[model samples]
Target: MHKNAFAIHGDIVWSKNPKELQTVEGGYLIVVDGISKGVYPQIPAEYQGITVVDRTGMLVIPGMSDIHVHAPQYGFRGLGMDLELLDWLNTHTFPEESKYANPEYAWRAYQIFSDDLLHSATTRAVVFGTMHVDATMTLMGKLETTGLKTMVGKVNMDRNSPDYLCEKDAATALEDTKKWLDEVEDSHFENTKPILTPRFTPTCSDELMEGLGKLRAERDLPLQSHLSENLSEIDWVKGLCPWSTCYGQTYEHFGQLAGDQPVIMAHCNWCPDNEVEILKENNVFVAHCPQSNAQLSSGIAPIRHYMDLGMNVGIGTDVAGGATLSMFRAMADAVAVSKLRWRLVDQNLAALSTEEAFYLATVGGGKVFGKVGSFDEGYEVDALVLDDSQIKTPLELTLAERLERYVYLAEEGGRIVEKYVAGRRVL
Candidate 1:
């Protein structure tokens, strides 16, 4: 065995596909230099001398991924749940995000959010920061210290935003974004990097979007933003850009949906067929924020349809809008909302199963980062050691049943005993 090789023995469970989950009862998962070596029934002879951490009774699963979350909104999570999408943003989101301009407030708030994220089941995330460059950098620095891999974006909004939060103009927005990216490039971050965020079509003028697209091409950075999330928002976009055929087309026309770049668009709840084709053509990833959609009265996304059409999909908390940071909550919400959609919205579609929901929370979402959220060989070893002993059950339960129970019932506390990012124990 290599000197750095180590193993953890537990009840291992992970998704093999949306329909199948691979389970190993009392198996040994080997790790060598932060890469998964594979799972074995027992420690192999070649690895016999290596260190083995015996987590006999715990359930070991791949770490969850949150593809869409707003780090600035973490401070106000669980509030303003009664409002609709546009109203909620005007009332809650923009106001709270505006506060990030204050360096001290940003540091304190981001530190708290980062600490919670480090302790939570999420090992990887794509997070949104506010328009303030220093504050966004502060959030990045705090998250970097937690040993989690993340992509943080400094938001760009030059129009249709509160005066306090909006940038002066497109040139100023691009200049600030360039400065932020240059700083990130020079810092040599190991697990964290920069993403380009144009708040959305409504807030981002065509000029600003065009400039951001150029910046993305120059830096070869990923992009993230909202999509057709609500009816009112869609109408507003149409009013703002009358010449565009659809909201997705507005992005494509501006080069924001460049074919060579990776983009994650949140709340694709109301995407039309043509827009769906555009998403598919560009191979764009959808961040399905189920709980946030429900909370904000946004319609349920056709996740089943997306799957049937072979579109890339992932789950996200979308905090404040989602009311919780738990990807387990996101999974349960995905399954529950899909049931509603299947029964009432579209009888032709099938409801999401526990296995599928689990897949979205792990493997499906992990694809955005590549080769994560699974125990396959040559994959990074981001995992969680979960102890569900607190849940009382009269009969002995299978590992799958236990996982389902944890997904639906685990509350806000320390159910996660340990968290690992790339084979390094971070918690």
Candidate 2:
């Protein structure tokens, strides 16, 4: 018998692809050494005697992923919904992030964030930290103890930010970022690493972007940042990078878009045809932060168009702007906003279905972390055992129907009976 082998019996469900949702009622998922072997209706004879973790009436699905979020903003979520992107940043976000310079405050706040995330359905994330190196490291430390896989960025913004929050200059910002990366290397966190983060074109100068680009090449790390999330923000980027054709072009000029390494840009709500082409060409991961866009009055992202264009797409709980960290909420918001976009903005494109949104929440976002968020053979064993008995209706529900309801109605904590990442139970 394989020491690492185990079996989970439940009503299994997972994405075969973006357009297909596979389900097996009364099935068994075979896992060995943190990798999925397959799902079967009957346990194979070879593994018949292995220990079976029974979840007979529960729903077993792939654990969700959060492609983009800000750790510093977790404390202020649901507070600054009235203001748009720029004003909200100055009024609420900048002030809150500046507090992270105090390591004690960072540890306290990040502990809450980490605890909540551990209890939530998100098993993998690409997270953002403020410019303060010690504070960012503090956040990573808290997350490391949670047994979750994450890439945390120590943000860089040398211009167009508050004096208290901004770095002294491009050189200082680059130096600090390098220092943070070195510390992360030394920390030897098993499931956490550093990502390159230039706040955005408005805040990051050309010199800073250039320096960060070099660091990205040298370290071979992934990058994450904002794109055309709002009209005013797009205009701001245009003013900042006058030589570029579009907002994404500025990042492209600095080799920040996906090519050799993965790049995830949050909230491409206003990307024009040219920018879309550039993003598609570079294979950038477009993080659809629908709830954040609505909360800040940013325009709805053309997610349907992006899907049709065959771009890599995922969901994000943009934290303070989004008001929640539930990828379930993010998935629901993605579907709701796409309906509005299809009905009002452009009738030519169709709205996203519940299964499609589930795909975005799982497989699409999982792509960034490499073969995660699915139960396909040889995929990592990131599984969620959900007891949705409370949400179930009197009428019989198929696994697909139950999953859709879980996406919109199911709360975390109690509903999540067992959460596993890489075959090890975390919650």
| Per-residue accuracy of model 2 over 1-427 as CA lDDT, tens digit each | 8779999999999998788899999999999999999999999988878889999999999998898999999998999799998999999999999999998899899999999999999999999999999999999999999999999999999999998999999999999998998999899999888899999989999999998888888889899999999999998888888899999999989877745778999999989899999999988999999999999999899898999999999999999899999988999999999999988999998999989999999889988998888998999989999998887468888899888888988773339999999888999
Q: Whole-model lDDT, candidate 1?
A: 0.91
TM-score of predicted structure 1: 0.98
Lowest summed lDDT across 10 adjacent residues in model 2 is found at 405-414
Query: What TM-score fits each model?
Result: 0.98, 0.98
Q: In candidate 1, which residue pairs clash?
A: none
Stretches of candidate 1 above 4 Å error? Answer: 259-261, 412-414
